[model samples]
Target: SGTAVLTPREPGGLPHGLRAAIALRAAAAVQDEELMAHYRARLEACPGGVSFATFAVPGTMPEDTRLAAILRHADLLTVEPRGATRDDIEGLKAADVTEPDIVRLAELCAFLAYQARLLMGLRLLRNA
Candidate 1:
């Protein structure tokens, strides 16, 4: 089964639509076409319809500390998890993100990293 992080453990803390949008953006970053399209549609059909085009451009994300924390954590986790520190965790806390929510967000990003690796491997095998 796919890692279904669309539904956050604490719904009120993080809405499903927002989670889906973030996941979609992460998928796009990794060039997972199918995953991106799936979540893109979900975001487009969300209650008020979220704009995810900016997701592809991290520099364009709103200047919200929470969002910045999430993106920073996602980047660090996927690119250089060994460099993560307590400050990283504290940053999310300073942004008002609950401890459990931070854990949930990390897990989601980890799953995305795994998905990206899987896609890359499959492509390489196909080419080989």
Candidate 2:
């Protein structure tokens, strides 16, 4: 069977703040009406998906914040220890990372987190 492609809906250019909130909610697997409404509103505002593409001379905060948020919601965070320079981060911010890149990065981190979480859960699942 072919793999299904899931594209992120554009959220009407909503501010990153709101968009991030919606994304975090979705990551948490929370399907409440309010969350859906927020996502819908953002999508209506930006039909082309949140401007994952930015040209603001790539600052650390946005990427840092996004990474932190993902870690918070994801079951695992994985670092490959590749040599990353400031320019790399800047480029990442400016370039539109292909959907495949995003998916791969997310999958790697999630897998790492999941494995760690599985072990932790096994040890603590019953106590809590």
Query: Which model scores highest in TM-score?
Result: 1
User: Looking at candidate 2, what is the lDDT of residue 79?
Assistant: 30
Per-residue CA lDDT of candidate 1, range 1-128, in tens?
13356564455455666666666767766667877887788777766446443553433465877876777676677667788899999988998888877887777777777777887888899999
Give per-residue lDDT, candidate 1, residue 87. 96
Error of model 2, residue 33, in angstroms:
40
Instruction: Please report, in order, the local distance difference test score of every candidate based on alpha carbons.
Output: 0.70, 0.38
lDDT of 2 by residue, 18-111 (tens): 3333333342343234434544554445434444322111121245544433333222223322443445444544454444444544543354
Model 2 stretches astray by more than 4 angstroms: 1-96, 125-128
Q: How close is candidate 2 to the true structure, as a TM-score?
A: 0.26
